[model samples]
Target: MNRYKHRAYNEELMDDLTAGGPSMDQTLRELETINRWLGGNFVTIDGLVKLLKKSPSRPLVIADLGCGGGDILKLVARWASKKKLEVELVGFDANPHIIEYAKENCKEFKNIRFEVQDIFSEEFKQREFDIILCTLFTHHFTEKQLTGIFRQFKSQAKIGVVINDLHRHPLAYHSIKLLVNLFSKSEMVKNDGPLSVLRAFKRKELVQLMNDAEIDRFTLQWMWAFRWQLVF
Candidate 1:
């Protein structure tokens, strides 16, 4: 087994600053599919279900950070609708094109909307959300950045924060490496899929980061398909 336990900051093709086109859109679509099949969406859904329990009577306002295709937000919106719960869902992403794509894809859901936002900006810090959900997003940041981000999340979220992200392990890395190479059509997917695993966290690493962020009231659970479901 490979024994290294440090985060790798390799550049993912999908993170290309100047990249925006049909291929970028295709890659995002593929990522949504992967999340669906790998049960990545369920991780956040489960956390949301728990968070919803805290304030059952109030109208809920939820925000999904780094919402590429807004798939998770759409799923949450549908779940809330089916339960007859009054809820508003918002999706945030820094890329304008991705935000446009998310809006177009989620146009059928009136309760869900998209916004272009830098999560670290003063505007984001000023806004308050009942529940903030992050899926497969935290791995993109360094530990120092994550500490600051988590602290902000604690300050801005009124109810709680749900973080669903990859677990870095030799098995996870190799399994995704094989699966993406075989099933993905986009070059960005073929490159970034495994790279994300390398950038992902170990359980201890997340625990330490949370400690550094000064967030104490939280539970971290290991979910299926190598995901960390953290609720704060």
Candidate 2:
């Protein structure tokens, strides 16, 4: 079977988000470097900058779904500080262990905090954010799951959403496999890096997903390093 023909069912080590320790910590650290070097981090930042243009006044609340180690939130925090934009940034993940680690990782930023939130839960739905971000997230679920998630996100985000996720392609798969093998010592990072590409979305799939969720106003652009920047 051609695994790339569909979202791969193969599980990644990061799937068990509850499992965290030195290895997961190392994985988080390495991912930060990879994202920064590959220019992936800027995708989210730029999307946010556009949203910021709409409303420069008042404090904005931003929540990151499936936030890993809170590194992205740290970037958002820094940007807000520099721009003098007051933002209450919250990083949400279902994994308590990861949330704990993220909390520790972002201790220096007083305005940023971490929370354990299941995106589909009632508790999550009741809460609202000015902008919701899902960086390298959303690909972890199947089509049905994402459709439902889109609905939830639309309801929760007061402003809009910024999604930075992988694009399923051969080059992305092979390139990540090669890069991880060369620099990663953690087995989880080595195995999951390539698998993530296999589980990512294609542009057409994203369009269909948006239609299903009744989301009409949105911009979907392909980014360098094989990523999709979907801003809604």
Candidate whose TM-score is highest: 2
Q: Pick the candidate with the highest lDDT.
A: 2
RMSD of each: 1.4, 1.1
Please give the distance, in angstroms, between residue 96's alpha carbon in candidate 1 and its true position after superposition. Answer: 0.6
Task: For residues 1-232, write the lDDT of model 1, one tens digit per residue.
Answer: 4544788998787565566779888988999999889888899989988877754787889999999988998899888888888999999988888888899889999999999889888988999998999999999999999999999998789989999999998888899989999999999988899899999998999999999999988899999999999999
Off by over 4 Å in 1: 1-3
For candidate 2, give the lDDT of residue 101.
Answer: 87
lDDT of 2 by residue, 74-184 (tens): 999998888888999999998898898899889999999888888878877899889999999888998898999998888888888999999999989999999999999
Runs in model 2 deviating more than 4 A are none
- What's the lDDT for all of these models? 0.89, 0.90
Clashing residue pairs in candidate 2 are: none
Candidate 1 collision pairs: none
